[model samples]
Target: MKNLICLTMLFAICQRTVGQQVELPKATFAMHTGFLFGVWGNYEARLGQRTVFLTEAGFSFQSMAVFTNEGKEDVITPVLLVGPRRYFKSKISKKKSGSARITRGFLGAHIKFKPNSFFLDSDGLYGYANHLGVFPNIGMKKTMGERFVMELALGVGYAHYFAKQEGWPENIDRPTVDLRIRFGFNL
Candidate 1:
């Protein structure tokens, strides 16, 4: 059933990509940290001058604390930050021997999903929570130092968790802050 859902979504994405007849530049790949946690990478193809089809994947190892004891778990995450990437147009030139670095900033929205993991408390009781959510994220990309280019983005979203058989509270508190940040370089 899960495979079916994933295939359906994949088909939808393929349809969108094939439907567009615009000729654009090749895809760009990037690796970054701060996407939820750990390291993540993305493949972005320019669908238009200000539009991008961004696909990202990463993993996060985290420990969560509820009203009970903390549980350590591993989660897999994939995100698509596909939307209009707002940037300034026109170009500037310098008369120096070397050209100056160009920096651009953008704000966009994305939809994301994370796989669940086993959560074991101190009492040996365990449960799992899988979340699917969306958030509005903003980021900037520019040259730093002489050769490094970096991008950072942060987003906030509300997630609902479904747990298995455990006396987990009926009204559990949500995370005080559900934010995702990614710092990576354009490749």
Candidate 2:
């Protein structure tokens, strides 16, 4: 009986040691889709303990198919974005909290490429130009689950364009707005 008790105690101690040594699962990658009258998707990769890399792509379409005079036209725009994100770590609960939960703020830049805006024949008459610009954005993200997160961000930047007319369309340079909602999952 004494030997049995000694063996049982040893087993309990071993179990406790093993339990205490268990490590928390590390976050990997996440993918999310959001809708704000339009659909957008984002993919994020964990870089380190406090940083992540993000890539985003999306498009917006008009419902009415109308052309200039009397036809239907479909206008679609595709965008690609890349940036580095700094994350804040929370002590409360890693599984229930997102990296943004602990983030104080972040700064990043993105470039947008737009095509199908210019016509060869209208080059000197009514011409459309492609735009290129850089923007710095700030935002926060909240982790609701181990694999789910929500984020909101806003940014203001400038865009440069080539104009065909010298006086018309006075506003050749304009300020742009960047508003976004993102969802992510661990890969």
Global lDDT of model 2 = 0.49
Candidate 2: residue pairs that collide: 29-186, 29-187, 30-185, 31-185, 32-183, 98-143
lDDT of 1: 0.50
Best by TM-score: 1
Q: Write the per-residue lDDT of candidate 2 for residues 5-116, one digit (tens) a residue.
A: 6534543443343211212234345565554444456665667544567776665442322223433444444556676654432323343334323222344455655443
Worst 10 residues of 1 by lDDT: 16-25
Taking all chains together, each candidate's TM-score versus the true structure is 0.57, 0.53
Local lDDT at 145 for model 2: 48
Local distance difference test values of all predictions, in order: 0.50, 0.49
Reference-based lDDT, residue 113, model 1: 57
- Top lDDT model: 1
Model 1, 95-179: lDDT tens per residue?
Answer: 3667544455554545565554443444554435555555455555655433345665565544555443234555332432335
Runs with alpha carbons beyond 4 Å of true place in candidate 1: 1-25, 35-37, 61-63, 66-100, 117-127, 144-147, 164-182
